[model samples]
Structure formats: structure tokens, C-alpha cells
Target: MKEQDTVDLFVIGGGVNGAGIARDAAGRGLSVILCEKDDLGEGTSSRSGKLVHGGLRYLEYYEFRLVREALIEREVLMNAAPHIIWPLRFVLPHSPDDRPAWLVRLGLFLYDHLGGRKKLPGTRTLDLQRAPEGAPILNKYSRAFEYSDCWVDDARLVVLNAIDAAARGATVLTRTPCISARRENGAWSVTTRNERTGETREFRAKVLVNAAGPWVNDVIQRVAGSTSSRNVRLVKGSHIVVPKFWEGANAYLVQNHDKRVIFINPYEGDKALIGTTDVAYEGEAGQVSADEAEIEYLMSAVNRYFKEKLRREDVLSAFSGVRPLFDDGQGNPSAVTRDYVFDIDENDGAPLLNVFGGKITTFRELAERGLGKLRTFFPEMGKDWTHSTPLPGGDMENADFESFQAKVKAEYPWMPRSLLQHYTRLYGTRLSRIVGEATSVDGLGRHFGGDLYEAEVRYLMDQEWATTAEDVLWRRTKHRLHLTEAQQAEFATWFSAEMREAA
Candidate 1:
């Protein structure tokens, strides 16, 4: 944390990949420093589809290696962090007008048998008329396919990895951007300035990692003063949230006329998440927003199969994110690969590792492989260990979240079911850190409405580098969706006035 300290590794991003690398490197006995220009996951890492799947559609592009690795990593992540990730069933309604029945069946067959399958159920045919999953679907789709995938709290996953990295002896600097990095004396001279306090610091590191999601190319050209043949294409994906119109915990996937698929997922308890129009984006990653055309496209796709039509009034919220896909020269943005590529510039004695495209489902593995690329630099660093290690709060036995829930209920009997569920789902074993021997609702301190309390707020500020209310409400937890606009504004005012250090 000093101004001119020497470290083994210095990472230049705070997204999931960078956080994962920091955690891995720290556990392997490397002195690491991870600096972020904003709050953790305040970028593409947060605005993801929130699913850990094998990319069933990638099969059409013949990305067998990517699919197989992702499929294998799905269960690995589920085991490492069960609190924020759990199994979910996806119901895909068949349409003879789109893809042939045999092709769909063959794709599902490969999805079932492609990677080692053990924890989740295999695909099965469903009678649309009899199965409850198809009750809201139109009768034209008589048959459906039910497959397995995992749901993730994308922002929380990023924060947890950063937390674990910090706990493993890595310095995490939020709201601090690396302004300059130069290679001198076979080391990296990195200088960072704090955006909040106008404080500056410098460090000498043995290696530099450019895991700056959307800004990878920018870092190469501007920050590092280095050039690379590799590049990333920004693909904009948009999603809309609406009231839950269908029953059951299962989600629905419908194929659009353009051959792209849309997911209708149960979200925030009483709402549905439908998304993703893949369009080539040239705008800023931070300024991305769901356009009217993208929103209309999502609704239209949902209406194609669902009997309950979705109008503009039903849309509660909408968000958009740009994917930093590795440019494969494909004209269609949807056809681009999600696989990651690495470029190592070992010129002039120092090394700069540039990470290209990657998806959330393969972040941990990506980190492992990223570290493997630096094996020559740190020969004495520890071997791979994240495979079985539990992240900060994901230490449940057998990763049984249901069993953990029962235990929590018995322990915090005084807590309401809704509040308990929220805390347990977000914090897991770390719930006690916030609860801290309090009894009853009043003991949790002033309620900010909808399970938002002073205790949780203080915990996030102290531990998770939460400087603003948006970090807590929108990113750390979805309290913004549950709380009214007035409540949110009041919380923001209270947070700013009461929390003087943050200001």
C-alpha cells in the first residue's frame, strides 16, 4: 500500500478476470496489487446474462474446445461458490418453423454428453400441453426441451473474488486508476491516482497484467506504450426486466426468427429478466444503455412464444453491456467467439500479459491459465489450488445451500423469512459478520426499506469498498429493484450526509 513499494505482480483492472487472477496469484505466494478505476464489477463483468452455461449455441460455430471447457468449469464454480450460484432448468419450446426438430435434439444431445455431466440433470422432452413449464407458452409450440444451467449473481461473484484476493494478502485499490506504466530495469513502474482523494502512488512490479475487459486495446496502445496484433470487438447486448408473468422457478428460452435465442428468467423474486440483442457497438462501454429498438426486439421475441404479451408498460427496467469479444473477423457480432486469447510482450526484459475476450462462465479457469502463462516468471509460486478451494463465504459442506438455509433459519429465528433469505443468499456464512449478535429487526439498526439496513450498509462500506449508494443498491444487492425511488434517494442522502469518510 506504500507509494513506492515493490511487488511481484500488478494487475490493471478490477473486473472478474483481474480479481480472479489477483486471488490466484496471492494464494500462490505472490505479492500482488490490484487497482480499479471504479468500484469492483462496475463494468461488463456486472452486466452479464447471469448464467453459467456451456454456450449451447456455440456448437453451431464448432467451438468444441470452448464449450467443453466451459461445461466443465460450470460445476467447478458451482462447487466453489454455491451461495450465489445454483441450478436452474431452462425450457426451450420447439418451433418447426425455425430449426428442424432433429437439429435441436442433436444439439441438446451433444450438450448432455459433450462434457462430464454429474451434478445437473440431462435434457428431456416435455409435452407442452401437460407440462406446467409450458402453461404460459402458446399452444403452437407443442413440444419443448428441458435442460440444466446455473444462475449467478454476477456482481457479487466479482466482489467475492476481490474480497478473497484481499484476504489472501493482495492489496485492492478501488477508484484508483493506473495513469502510467513504464518498463524500466526489467520491472514495471506503475503510477496510480485515486479518483476520490486526488492521492497518487507508484509501485515497481515484476510483471503487469492487462485484464482491463473493454479497455484491453486502450491499455496496450495508450497505457503500456506497446502494440499487439490482437484486438477485441465490442458487441452490445441489451436486456429488459418486467413483472413475472409465468409460474414456476423454471425459465423459458425461445428462438427468434433471426435464429438468435432469448431467455425469460425469473429475477429478483417477482420479476422476469429477458434479454440480449447482439449488435455491433461503437459507443463507450460505460455509457451503454438499452435502446428502444433493442427493448422492442426483446419484447417481440418473448411474445412470439408466450401467450401473455409484454407491452412497453410492463418493462420495469432495462440495461445494456458491451462484450469485449476477441475479433475473429466475423461480420456478424453474434457469431464471434467467447474464448480468451493471451499476448505476452516479454520485450525489453519486462513482461506485459494482455487478455482478450472471455465470458463469466470461464473466469476461474481463465485465471488459472493466465497464471500458467507466467510460470516462467514465478517458478517458485504455488501450484493450482482454486479448483477445490471455497471463495470467501462458499464453505458449505458438499456445497449444499439448502442445508445451509435450514441451519440459518434455526440460528436466526427472530429474522423474517425475506430478510433472512436475502442475507443468506448474498453473504452465506458471512451473514453473522453483519448480524453481529443483534436480536430482532430493530437490532439491525435503521431500516432503509425493503430489508436494507444500517448494518448491511456499514458492512459493505467497511469491507467491500462501497463509496456510493449505487454500489450497494444496484451492484452489491438488488435493493434498488425492491425499494421505491423515494426510498433510494433518501438512502443516498443519508449515506452521503452520515458517511463523511466516503465523501
Candidate 2:
């Protein structure tokens, strides 16, 4: 191994938790490297329900610490990346058959006060018969409750963390898997193979962080050749996207007969994203998909409350991801805790920190706390600072997204409103970097489809570590949902040729 390749830390995942930890450690002046087997957030991080909420149902499980921590993190994350994380109101229709109104009210009350509620409004009792938000609900539900939570672009959140980590002097390697890691002479000898180039790299690190999400155990046993008393439970959650059925910005949460909750949220400007059935899964996390039975289950859940019924044909797309919850001897998958657990195994003075379960909302805090556990080893590292810092492209004045949009519009009056909004929503303060000196849509170079132009593609390739067509279409942005099949194929062909030429 080359002496120059030695570092203080090596993180083995590109999901939210892993990326967040790399960013935190790098910002604290630690030498860091983050490796991902696939694209950033190609796993559970991107497939989430996309809500930065303090799981209200967890209240029934008495997970107060997790709920409170997540609630507090909502505002903290919004301030960090206001463009992608913003407050959203959810309307819950009263269904007396599922639970009593008082129980629901009590849960809302705890949600409102638990995290030092500020910026977001408190809960309100709604008269569904009279309110505009109730227009789409069936008249049988005459009452509702409205509360606040935040929505996030999940995949982008992971990418932005990686970007920030790189900016802070962290080496980030995507499409690279840690092939082997072993404790030798009180240090970790790690080896990774780049899938695209078929190149192998070696490194020596003082500490190893295994934030591999669904593959946590794989890294522990297979890669590091170590064992842990802790185990990970794989739980599959799926979501379906369809055309917008309702006319409001607020989302709807309905209680199911199985004592679970379903979220119907507005998505990608004229689409509705509904989802999430929790089933204990034993299959490979990478090969998981929404089956017919799961799809029918989701459709039935949505049809129970909305006036516009959802049919099989209405689903435009469906995706599934597996959550690696820490096995706590829970019988029901839904009852599994979303809280994170860290197990540090010091094998002959070399430490391997294996991160178990964590949701997106608390990733920053999780990173901070994870690093805190390693303070005795690196006491000279910098103190916690991510709490008040703004992420890249999120440094708008006071984190005001609307004001930033107005500024971008003033700067580029010739840009179409739809495309401008797309740029601002995804890039925030970095819109100018993507638009450059382009005076009109024609200046943006080739138009793939919808709002996707060649300039944005180049920016993604140059700055965001995007390589494949799928990386740009699905994760970096949701252009896949807007473009036709032929347009997609054409874009893929063009992108491959351009990448080959650049290489």
C-alpha cells in the first residue's frame, strides 16, 4: 500500500447515513474516504417515502427519544438545505373505525410539542365538510386534523452530502465496492475495486465506518471478516407514483385497517406519490420489487379515503427499497424501531464502527454522535459544526427559497418559468452555475426532453459525480418520470457517447 493513500477514516456506503458521516468527519478536519457500491442513494435512502417526519405511529411503540430527535432534526435539516427540505402540511381524515379521535389528538399533541416546535404551525382541528383541503375526501369523513412535517428530495440529499464532503477535502468514490478490509498492525488495510474502470485501489485507515445500510451485515462479516452480536432486520417498503388526483399542495394520511398509515403526497409537479406497505423481507435488498399483492394492497389503502379511486392502470411507476432495521426481537415489521444503533468492535486496537438503522431526518445528528463515539481516538479533530451550516446550493439568504427563486427569475428573464422553477428547486443558489451565460433556452444546448437540457447534464457530470443516464434521470433528478421511452433511449445513447469521448 502506498503511504500517500493512508487516511484517518474510510466510510463504506454512499447512502444518506454514510455520506452524512463522511461530510461530518471531513468537515472536522479528519482525512476521509467514502466508497459506494453503486450510485449515491441507489438503495434505501432514495426509496423512502420522502418525508422528514417524526414517525407519529412510533408513538404507539413508545419511541419517544427517536420521535423527539427526528422532530428536532426536521427544522435543523430544513435550515441546512431549504431548497430540498421544506415544511409540508398533512391532512388526516377522521376515521373512527381505525382509532379514537382522542388518541389521534394525543399523538398530534406530542408531535407538536416534543421537538420545541418552531417555524412550523401547531395542529388544528379541521371541519372537512367546510374546508377547502377536504374537497377531495369523501363526505362520510366530516372532520380532519392538520399538522406539519417536512418533505425532502431524498436522493439529492445524499448526493449533496457527498458534494459537501468532497468540498471539505474528502475523497468520494461511487460505483466502487470495498472488496476487503482487515485489521493489521493496529490499522485497517482496505481495498476497493472500481466497477466502471476495473481498477483496484488500496488504502490504510485508522478507523473504518460501516454505514452500508441494507448491506451492513455483509460488510461486517464478508468484507471486514468480523462478527457482531447485533443483527439487521430487512423490512421492505414500496411506493407508487400516479397522476395527481387531488387539487391541493397538502398531503393526506389515512389510517388503514391493519393499523398502519399511508401517505398520499404531491410529487414532481402534477403527480401523486402514495405508498409504503411494510413486510418482513428475506430477499436480497438489491433485487426487491413491488409485487402484485403489494401493489393491490397500496391501491386498496388509497381507495378507502379518496373520492377519485386509484386503479391498476393509474400507477405510472412503482419502486421498492429495504430498510435495515436493527433486530430488536420485534415480531411485526411495522413495529421495528427506526432509531439507529452503533456497534464499535476494537479488534487489537483497530476499531470498526458498524452503523445499524437510521432514517434520513436524523442523519446529521447520527453522524455527529457517531463521530463523538470516536473522540477518544481523535481528540484533536474539530468539534461539531454541521448543525448551523448550510449545504452546497442551499446558502440562500436566510434559507428563503421563494426569495431565491425570485432572484433567479430576475437574473434570467428569458428562461421559461417551468424550467426556471425546476432549476431553482433542484439547484437553489447554484442555478447560475448550471445556467451560466445562457440568455435563452436555445443556449442550453441539446434538449433531451421536458426541462432537461445538455448544460444541466454537463454540470451533473462535472460536479455531482453523475456517470450513467439512469443517474441523471432518476436520482440526480426525476426526469425519467417526464420523458418518453424513445426520448430516454436517445438521451442514453447521447450521454454514453459523450462520456466515452470525455474519457
Q: Which tens-of-lDDT digit does each residue in 1-503 have in candidate 2?
A: 33346799999999999999999999999999999999999988999999999999999999999999999999999999999998899999999899899999999999999999888999999999999998889989999999999999999999999999999999999999999999989999999999998988889999999999999999999999999999999999999999998887999999888979999999998998888989999999999999988888888988888898989999999999999999999999999999999999998889999999989899999999999999988999999999999988899889899998888889889999999889988988888889898999999999999999999999999999999999999999999999999999999999999999998
- TM-scores of the candidates are 0.99, 0.99
Q: Candidate 1 at 194: error in angstroms?
A: 0.5
User: Mind sharing the TM-score for model 1?
Assistant: 0.99
- Expressed as tens digits, the lDDT of each residue in 323-378 for candidate 1 is 99999999999899999999999988789999999999999999999999999999
Error of 1 at 412 (Å): 0.6
C-alpha lDDT of residue 485 in model 1? 96
